[model samples]
Target chain A: AQSVAQPEDQVNVAEGNPLTVKCTYSVSGNPYLFWYVQYPNRGLQFLLKYITGDNLVKGSYGFEAEFNKSQTSFHLKKPSALVSDSALYFCAVRVGGFQKLVFGTGTRLLVSP
Target chain B: SQTIHQWPATLVQPVGSPLSLECTVEGTSNPNLYWYRQAAGRGLQLLFYSVGIGQISSEVPQNLSASRPQDRQFILSSKKLLLSDSGFYLCAWSVRGVAGGQETQYFGPGTRLLVL
Candidate 1:
């Protein structure tokens, strides 16, 4: 079965500092990876997805992720973090020819001002 | 522009009570709809998905059931709710890709269910 793992439970960073949220996935075939953000008591918002393209995929809110096939990782990254960027982040993977997406346990991002 | 809506925003019911959560999508036709439960604000567990009207596929066997009577309307219900059913329920929709690739799923605002 396809699965995604987000190792960090929470990550704390200072405002304006670079931030990275790690994500690794396991799938039988080529993986369709995605990143989503969620605020308190709100549904998840799509950030970006990696189907087949360049190694790096840019997304909304100045966030981006890199798909490293060799490493089987798709890590969300931002050059500079903001206090508003603090939220829960999730990584999901969809195996080829599958409709269901396997999601990882979310990582809480805490940005200090 | 496409959008998804779910209601009621919050619900409180007894453990043995019934449950009915409704979700509808606008500005899109023949879109795939899904029902997911998020427990303790963590990873999401897909409960059901529908490729078209009257075609419901259940991913988990639990106290909940889903029905798609209309093209864009999906409903989740249960005859008797359980304490474990208390969580955030989300409805999502995605367009089917031509090449059979996976598409991005757009989620609704979600409904908070609390069972006493």
Candidate 2:
């Protein structure tokens, strides 16, 4: 079975500092990875996805992710964090030829001003 | 432009009461619809998915059931609610066919369900 793991329960960072949210996935075949953000009492919003492309994929709200096939990781990154960037982040993986996605438990991001 | 909508933004029902949640999509045709439950604001568990009208695939077996009576309308229901059923329910849609599996899904605002 395909699965995604987000090791960190929460990550705290200062405003304007660089931030990283770790994500690792396991799949039988080619993996389609995605990053999503959720605010309190709101549905998830798609940030980005990695199907087949360059190692780096850029997303919304000045966020980006690096897909490292060797490491089996797709970590979300941002050069500078903002207070508004604080939210819950989830990593998902979809195996090739499947429409369903398996999601991680999610990591809470806390950006302090 | 495409948009997804889920009704009854917040619902509070008794444990034995019935449940019916509705979802609709606009500006798209023959889209794939999905129902997911998010427990404690964490990961999402896909409950059901429909590729077309009258076509429903259940991912998990629970107290809930889903039906797609129309091309863009999906419904989730249960004869009797359970305390464990309380969670945030989300509806999503993606373009069907032509990279459909690889397509990005757009979500609705979500509905918060509380069972007493």
User: For each candidate, what is chain B's TM-score?
Assistant: 0.97, 0.98
Off by over 4 Å in 2: none
Q: Residue B25 of candidate 2: its Cα lDDT?
A: 98
Stretch of 10 with least lDDT, candidate 1 chain A: A94-103
- Model 1 misplaced regions, further than 4 Å: none
Q: How far is candidate 2 from the true structure (C-alpha RMSD, Å)?
A: 0.9
lDDT of 2 by residue, B6-103 (tens): 99999999999999999999999999999999998897999999999999999988999999999999999999999999999999998888563588
DockQ each: 0.74, 0.69
Best by DockQ: 1
Q: Give the Å error, residue A62, model 1.
A: 0.4
Estimate the lDDT of model 1: 0.95
lDDT string, candidate 1, A10-108, tens digits = 999999999999999998889999999999999999999998979999999999999999999999999999999999999999987745889999999
List of chain A TM-scores, every candidate:
0.98, 0.98
Q: Write the per-residue lDDT of candidate 2 for residues A1-113, one digit (tens) a residue.
A: 89999999999999999999999999888899999999999989999999897989999999999999999999999999999999999999997664598899999999999
